[model samples]
Target: MTRSIDTLLVANRGEIACRVMRTAKSLGLTTVAVHSAVDANARHAREADIKINLGGAKPAESYLLADKIIAAAKAAGAQAIHPGYGFLSENASFAQAIADAGLIFLGPPASAIIAMGSKSAAKALMETAGVPLVPGYHGDNQDYETFREAAQRIGYPVLLKATAGGGGKGMKVVEKEADLKQALESAQREAQSSFGDPKMLVEKYVLKPRHVEIQIFADEHGNCIYLNERDCSIQRRHQKVVEEAPAPGLTLELRQAMGESAVRAAQAIGYVGAGTVEFLLDARGEFFFMEMNTRLQVEHPVTELITGQDLVAWQIRIARGEKLPLTQDQVPLNGHAIEVRLYAEDPDNDFLPATGTLDLYREASAGEGRRIDSGIEQGDSISPFYDPMISKLIAWGSNREEARQRLLAMLADTQIAGVRTNLAFLSRILAHPAFAKAELDTGFIERHTEQLFVKPSTQSAHFWKLAAAAWALSEPKTTRQDDPNSPWANNCGLRIAQPRRFLLHLACGEEQQKITLREADLAGVCLTNDRLILEQHGQRTSHSAIRQGNTLYLELDGQIHSISAVDSIALAEAAAHPQGGLTAPMNGSIVRVLVSPEQQVAEGDVLVVLEAMKMEHSIRAPHAGTVQAIFCSEGEMVSDGMVLVEITGDAA
Candidate 1:
């Protein structure tokens, strides 16, 4: 049946939603966007030809509501629904529902999704298909005794994985027998909480394994092709942080073997559209099947850059019952491509997700070999209801070095503010020599932990000067009349000379500085020929500056600096009190509160568990103290630095 897909509805958000719509529109298909209440003004929502309101922001109320999504698609007269990964992308019932609703589901079949839905089931199927399987227990017994026996048989140093989970959730490593019980319990709890499936599979943990995956595409015409492999070894908390196509260290023979195995896995289940067959490459050059993602991956950009074929376009075409664009021999695997996920996370703070409005967002030129796939704009909000990824920055080069260098330059040039980002942290990782040499593993981030998580230093002198100039320029004509106590007030002039001295307070990260500028510097701080020339401190520095509201983005050297004017006194006062207070580290929802008023708590006791951007963060007591007050309760949304609990004094 060859049905034309005229109207396509995308049931996702963030970068992926925008990414899918671009291809759908390119194919001349009308794009319909579904947005939650909180995401009504999101970039993805605004980018579509037609928009449907899902009524709520949380996934449960919006993206995860299968019935609502189908209804929206039907209401918009969409011919097909494209589940852009995550949410209900892999839900067998959702696929069946879409099919039953007489709308095409731009993904694998419901049967294929079911075959690979659970880790245990998928491994069994792989073993049956004559593919290499890792040494593990993939049985039906979920009892404690059965698990204990499997762990004992598998020996020490094993991994407990949730059968129906991904994204490092519901996973744990037990190195010793004594820790097996607790590890299993924790893994099962997390698994049940995440996937509603506590069933587990025990596997022998590879000492040092490279996380490699092959991108596979299939058509409804019984044809499949492997588009080569991606090395997603650079990870944090078991989730891929950086990915590159054509995994660096593999020889031609091993690559062929891996690619063949991936095709076999895909063909066995009759996979349609884009899918990834993940494998763990051990130090001995041997590979073992890990799992198969039944949907398009988050790091699919690298694969597309290398193959020169749009995976999203292929998905749409296949959903419309079109044949494969090319055979295996026709697939081009040229050039090296790399992608880094730009997340709104604080690397120094245990990589906790940060949420807030993007006070200033500026991206580098994304053309030709450089690209930034993002759904955020200057004023977009990174809410706590979904993934914290701001974008995926992809760079392509003729060779590995060229691609690495291009990504490094782009990472430095990317400018984002309002919330703490992993920008500086990503720059350090790419600059590391180990990464440059392609020596990577799943533990790459942990191996170079000391160097990669360095604290950000103060902004350059030129940036501060630019910030001062921008603040001065933002002052209104009625600045003196707006507030009599204004620093720039006419009556507050200590020196009324030709070059008036103005003191401006600014805060950059953790450091605050008071920069004094003269009237001559302000007069000469002019934008001429698209360049901001500032003359201050007897030094002249000229750079490109983009001013938006109180924020000033400066391009100094090759790096981008986002600077904003802030009150130094207000920041100092916040830092003044550091005792007996529990403040939310980032904007998040209070998942659990463990303390009460007047309750004596021990030092290091967990007082709250905050859920932000799908990651849980524990708030611990700084010292043993008596709880004086509890200001916030569980399920309540709290902003960054909002005090949740207050203790009077240290416990006796």
Candidate 2:
């Protein structure tokens, strides 16, 4: 029953689509890509042999449109559509539609997806299959009272998760009974927005649990095997940030047990293709089934690296009615591999998703156990229409230490501009003592927050010198083309009878500083190919620096520092607006406007709710004040830093 796949269509975007295309093209299969309007010029679309523009930016308007995707696949002559995780990957209806259209869905059957699609349903199925599960309510009752009673029965500090959701959306940890109502409502709203389902289930919020998941592959012939396990304990907002294969401190017996359980879970649903069974392992080695991801996991790379197998290729083979690549004992546990997700976000500001051009995007050189899987290039725009993930940096080594060090070096070699990123935060996490000692759990980030979160401080003296040197050595841009003789035409401050000196006002983070740059200070400095070399007082230092307009992005001490030159007008505006103005942190649609014109509000009160990157963010009051004006309405799309509400602070 094996059918040849002459052409393949990837019905998703970003790294996963690009990743699948790489393998498909290598195997001599013509690849087709379907993109939204915003992704017309994206890397995934550009790499494919043929591309179809689905029209629109939002997921619901584009990638999630299953019929449009199937039609595009047919029009492109693709025999199979690979829903590469996210979008319609785990969607049972989308899978059924592809099958109904007589096209192969490079994933599990619709029936399998349905069995494990909902967390509540999956928990019940796992319970029936003799898989250990945390005590909770998984009933059909969607009333608030039902959830309330369930939470009470489950005791305080319960976890509420969307029945039809993954990736932390529609999930919340209610610490007490008093906060259950609001938490439930917020979770339901997020669930409805992300998965179109407001149904939720409650479970005990396990303390200090390690998130370990097994990678299982099944074929149409009923052959099933577990590739290995990945520890995705390092997370933020319930989304995995760092993942690694051969979970630290996992014994051979424990691994075998988990792998067997995962295989059973997959076989129980008559699953085929790649899937993941997530488990929460406690301190005493007790494990409980969390849920099953019916599609490939985002952290699949770690398993591939450890097992030396292409899970995507296995999926394609399985869809073509082939048997499993390896048996239970044939799965290899080679070395260790680690992956960290690089995102366009502000870690200092609650990891809020950032959007803008990738002004100066650069990646660490791949090879020698270092791999960078990304779908973005320099000068690309990170739109609000999709995920803010820039790339996933993966490193493999002979052991965990080697892998961790390689990843740290990779982070140091990477540089990004235009938007804030978590590169520095990631570097600190890898360098942290606790992480080095394998003190990992779901609360790893919070448990070691003080060490992982670096506070914003003033730039160092050497940093100022480097910034001045880079600026002085770089060619200045023309300000006025019409009048070459005008004083404004000369960007460099050139006086008629004095040494050249420039007055620079720099803004870095929240600290602003003024520096006087003299030509003599840059006498022994040079900038060639964006590499800055400075020899000051017989001390030589080299750094990578990129100058874009009035902004200078310099990599100093393994951290990227974005410093902008501010003019007098910018300074005046900053001084005038000393009171914290409520602005959209990122490009997103306004979900709720909680305040009105001239409304009095207390400090820390939520002013507006904004939905971006599939998560909700609150624009809270900086201080007690009176809302002078409301400039934004609910459901309005706003750009980053766009002022939504203006408030006059009380006398301060």
Computed on alpha carbons, the lDDT of every model, listed in order, comes to: 0.84, 0.88
lDDT of 2: 0.88
Please list the residue runs of candidate 2 whose C-alpha ends up more than 4 Å from where it truly belongs after superposition.
476-503, 509-511, 535-540, 569-580
In the range 1-652, model 1's lDDT, one tens digit per residue, is: 6888899999999899999999988989999999999999999999999999998766767888899999999999999999987778878999999999999999999999989877898999999988888889988888877878888998878888888768877688788888788667667766665556688999998876899999889998889989899999998877888999989978989888999999888888878888889999988888899999899999999988988988998898888888999998898889999999989888898888888889878787766799889998998998987888999999999999999999998886677777778887888888999999999988788888888876656677866777677656555434467587766675225565565666877665566678898777676577654357877678887766666666566656544456667855766796896554789988877878888899998888888887766556789888887898998998898988898999766544
Candidate 1: residue 269 lDDT (0-100): 83
| Residue-wise C-alpha lDDT for candidate 2, range 317-343, written one tens digit per residue | 888988887888898999999999998
- In model 2, which range of ten residues has the least summed lDDT? 470-479
TM-score (C-alpha) between model 1 and the true structure: 0.88
TM-score of each: 0.88, 0.94
Per-prediction RMSD in angstroms?
4.2, 3.0
